[model samples]
Target: MRFRIKKVINNNILCVTDADGSEMIVTGRGLGFGHKVGEQVDSASVQKTYRMTNPTVQQKLLDLLEQIPYEHFLLTDELVGEIRKRISYPLNESLLITLADHINFAIKRQKQGLLYKNPLLEPIRECYPEEFKMGRYCIKRIKEKLSVSLPEDEAGFIALHIVNAELNTSMSVMNDITRFVDGCIKVIESYYGKKFDHTSLAFSRLAVHLRFFAQRLFQNGQDSGKEEYDKKFRSLIARNCKEHYQCAETVAAYAENVWHKKVSDEEILFMAIHLKRVNLSEQHSD
Candidate 1:
């Protein structure tokens, strides 16, 4: 797996190949040690450059460089320059590359019958009163695109694209965490159930809420204590969990199908962690 450097972006390197390749961002301190633009990276060194969860994605990055071993800086700017026109945040070069990587991998995944399965209702159904139709909405659009519903992570990826374009790019500027929460609520409630304990419901709801809370807080130029937000979000999740921690598994089932970057085991485990923290804190004094 040898690849040529297609672009040198400060500490973030990117390369392209003959077969559609992902624009991988090389990360690992000193991995860039003495590397220059257009230099062909040996196969062994390429493995040391980055650690990505997706093996196919890792190979794609390597392939891109292997295919195109030499590049001029002007070509790098040219690609970015073209993408910038359509992208909301080109200056956010790293995210731009991430999105490109996602798109390329998604296409390949599609070829391998690995489409995402948007788990909109399986988990929410147990709760019953949430009525989130996004699962259905996503299912409809996804089926139309692929002749079948996409998987959860794939749905998450597509939703990310929609969320990015509809609200704003620069997830930092994104303030729609509440909207995502509301969307989840609507999807759950839309299912055949209509009654849920507020406490049980809040756990999943708060989880959705906090997904973007940190970024929104920073974007708004506020001096927010993440611990403070974590406390609140946790309190809500715990009250819900104490009533029914069992539902956390269901919520995780949905998350597993919805989100891609993190596995469901991780998501469900974090829910417990958040709940435990809440039990200890009780409540922060004003």
Candidate 2:
């Protein structure tokens, strides 16, 4: 397909439009070196083309392309490839823009000797281990390619970006979910009078559960419609596991008061079961 250059972003990047008027960002070595507006680009010269359907995101990418170095964008593209290889979940296309912008700013900050710590790093590591591992890989690649050493906190930040893309949510919403998960964990610990072993599988499972639980809470997607089997299971757990069930109730109440979302009975039951497993695991570990 023939592409007409609408704007030359850089020597390697061009903002082009097809015959149907759909805008695309095409990148290749020297693709835009001698190209001007309204010039037809050889399709063979285009190495990569990104079609951003969202106008706002497309504009943001265009603005970012103008500001950040093309190398940073290429580095992000490499990291994105690594992310896809490591996880099977569908990632939002906005990851390209957000992650590239993040890497650009991070490199700039490192040059300025400004180190910002991610507060949710611990929770993120415990909840999203796969994405966090990819984040580490991203920094390792940055160090190899650009010789810039980014802190582990940056890895956490990158993981959150991946999580945001996977959930198709905004960074603010992810922040809220992280905080909510942290709060729920605190509530569980307070009720149990013990801290969780962060390295344990049980804690990891609980954190993962609470992370998605918070997502549903903030998204107002609490379970609806009770089933007879679900009702029986909730009753059985409430009777057999009173302490864990009570802790779950406290967590539900905490969610209701702070997040203003009522946890469904099925959700509470599941929380109680997870809590029981966590308690049992902790006891066995001790």
Candidate 3:
């Protein structure tokens, strides 16, 4: 508990030495209340100690802490480290950081009766109407629980996780599933020169698989169980695309090439034959 103050530089600044032989510049109105340059400073009112972990965040942390009012709670350094560990993609890292920041800010804003309006609302309507609906649903859940509105992207990702979660996958594993989904979406977009819509029956079924993925993430605590969930989701996506969709074999060939897997021509021919039979016979047994 014994600490020494070396110098009182100004009204609020003081040089202090701790019992552990560490010296730091202490700045606060309370620091120099009665303590002079050569006097001992009280150990109380020590808000926090700052030491850089990455050294890259040194400037950023200093800048933020200086301007950003200290909130009741914040994103833990452990959570940030976990994100950087689980995701290697730079885009994902930045997105996850923003997500964490939003969560931190939302908690602080709740006290002021302020709710975050989603800036992504228009974009979600134009670019992802289907996901937007699901996002709205997730927001309803949050609202019912906390009476606070969340931004669309947060709701969207939460819904995506909810829809994608299966009973056997962990969050870390679901992250990979989402990464793969992004890759699949890219390939589909490139082949068709248009974004895929979840409004279609085939895509709707695929979205169901994503929901199962979300279920898995929240339920499954085991790391090894993720592959089972992803395997089911991948198979579900493929099955919906092949059986329920009217996409051309030419399009099928594109997916085959992108996924580096062989999709048999029988898949398309069988779907066509089965569809024709169902149209003509109207018999479930047939």
Candidate 4:
């Protein structure tokens, strides 16, 4: 459908108003070249349409496009298209615009030698293996096309963004989820009076479990399972691994206090086992 160009940001991009009266940013080579306000854009010439509903993100994207070279958008289009094709999960459409803005800024920062490290990189890789792998792939493509070497930490950041989109949650919500997971880890550490190896496979599994656990808690308010066998399994764990089970209880207590919802017995059982394995691994390594 044809849209009226509201404003031209540059030769390659323009802000246009759709028939629904909402604004959308359209991008294509020479799409805005000689286009002016109140001008009709030939619908067939549109290469990419960013229908982002968040005004703040849209404005930031417009600002980013103004500052960065036009090629960033082209690269972002191909990268996002490939990511959509490769990832099995459904990602939010907003990611198309937001990721491009992030990568463009990241490239600019990398070039200026002002790189930032993602402190959660290890946790992210351990927790979201598939998303993190896709993040690395995004960086590889950037390196190949743009010739910029972004650090591995960038992959983690990108993965988080993907997670955000997948969850249909905002960055703030993701931050809260991360803090919730970290708080649970602290409770486990305090109970054992020692730190578990974050790099250990068992710890990674625990983190991954807690990641989805927190997500479910936020999304649906509680975990879903009513099997009597699950209760029996948890009881068995409590009897066999009393100490780790106790630690898991403390974590469960924290969850209840924060979310006002009791953690499922199945969750506590799985967590205790993971904590036990991780603790044993750490002691052996020591």
Candidate 5:
């Protein structure tokens, strides 16, 4: 199976077209050496081929690979492979581009003594435990391979990348989700007149719940329907957890006002319960 070279990125990477006219990014040492467009590439020598089926995503991958060090690119590829095996959900191919870009930047930052701390690291870890664990594994691998010691916050960032990939949402929507979760946190903190220790398990659990709640809102576009049982439970919360229920209402109101979307009563109920636990812990600590 021969491929026609379309463009040579470097001696180790090139873009080629298969017999079916499908474009692929081929990688192999010396594969693109002295290669010219329209030249025949021996498929046997190609070490790996990534389908350039999505033009936008593939172009982003090309752009990122072009800037990243070759060794780092290989490391990122291995990390992605490990993550794929460990996680249950199917990750999008776009993880290749985004995760590569992130890992490359992370290494560069660590080397330069300039690490951007993830403010939501605790929340991210709490919300996506499995992904966060995978992120830790990824960081460990990076340290072993690159000798770059990164902070735990980097693990949270990686987890967010994995979660973003699993959701198959665009980067923009992922950003919105992050912002929404932050807003919800602020609402909770403001109502209680205190900052929740972000590293606290309770805070992390709340963060995780809010992340999924935000995902549901963005995915379905609205709070559509509530089952009779759910309505009853929500009402029960309103009756019993009065203070917690009010805090939830404040959060729901803030989300609705800013995003112009309705928050389901069911969401308010769960959030109130979560908030109740957090507030109770704070009181106990005091």
Candidate 6:
């Protein structure tokens, strides 16, 4: 309950330790303005307290807090609050530092007229709709608070960060997953001889499925379970939806070649079913 300021990060942030010697980073307006080492942090002055157990992560956050503007951390705190309200999943606490660092850098880039387009923007938007929506909210908040109008591409980049936090994975892994999803979608488009309707629910569903498929492939190294009922259902799907099943086969082949992992029949069957829905949705839209 009581915190002794071990170090002052800024006028608004303090690195403190509780009675049990657990380190925590506490933040609030002017919380550290007149604070000194070994000083007790007024409980009322603390608005947010991040209990950092990982020493590496704690150090990274402390470094980030020192380097970036205090207001960026405040903005990220607000964004993380909004994210918790919308998302039911437990997010990695590292999101606080990473998002704040990203926002600060993005604003610096925008001010300098350096705008980088995110190549995975569409795939990200389709695969992670909720996170992408939160990314847009992040953009809106930055514009309102910092007066920086970042490109929509930045929203996709921010969405990836949120996805990384949600999955407790690295950014590179998320990038790989998005790229794999995009490649699989391209294979589907090639098989169907047409582009997908990005806004369609079927396309969104397929994208999400492929995203998780890739995540599973990377994390679990393929599903090898082959139940009799699963085999029967796969056969039934193949027999009923020949064209879509073939498309799914092509996607499976693509995944195998790229990831060097065998795709299970269950995975292919699900892919075929998704393809069938997408095909029907495409026809209806046409």
lDDT winner: 2
Better of 3 and 5 by lDDT: 5
Worst 10 residues of 4 by lDDT: 217-226
Local accuracy of candidate 3 as per-residue lDDT tens digits, 213-274? 32333344224435666566546554655533344354345445654434334433333343
- Residue-wise C-alpha lDDT for candidate 6, range 61-129, written one tens digit per residue: 989999999888888989989998997667898988889999999999989989998988988887788
**Winner of 5 and 6 under lDDT:** 6
- Writing each residue's lDDT as its tens digit, candidate 4 over 72-186 gives 7788878778878877678887786778888988998998999898988866775677778889999999999999999999998888888887777878778677777877877
Per-prediction TM-score: 0.27, 0.88, 0.32, 0.69, 0.74, 0.88
- In model 5, state the lDDT of residue 68: 86
Kindly list the per-residue Cα lDDT of model 1 for residues 1-286, writing each as its tens digit: 6566655544434442312454454533344557777676554544224434566656654545333312222232233344345433324333323444454455556768876654533333322222223323443543564454445555344344434433345543442443334444444334314533444534444544444432333233233346666667756665665532434454544443553223233344454655444333433311
Query: Mind giving the per-residue lDDT tens digits that candidate 5 earns over 1-286?
Result: 9999988888899988888988879898888899999999899999988875689888887777788887788888999999999987889888978888889899988989997978778666545778899899989999999899989999988988998988888667876787788788878889888887766777767877887788888886545365888888888988999988999999989888998768888788888999998877777777
The residue ranges of model 6 lying beyond 4 angstroms of the native Cα positions read 53-55, 87-90, 280-286
Off by over 4 Å in 4: 18-22, 53-64, 170-176, 179-208, 216-286
TM-score of 3: 0.32
lDDT of 2: 0.90
lDDT of 2 by residue, 90-195 (tens): 8998999999999999999999999998989998887788889999999999999999999999999999999898878889999989888878888888888888
Backbone atom clashes (below 3 Å) for every candidate: 28, 0, 18, 0, 1, 0
Which is the better candidate, 3 or 6, if ranked by lDDT? 6
Backbone clashes counted, model 2: 0
Q: CA lDDT, every prediction?
A: 0.43, 0.90, 0.45, 0.82, 0.84, 0.87
Please report the candidate that would top TM-score against the real structure.
2
lDDT of 4 at 209: 74
lDDT of model 3, residue 49: 42
Higher lDDT: candidate 2 or 3? 2
- Model 3, runs deviating above 4 Å: 1-135, 206-286
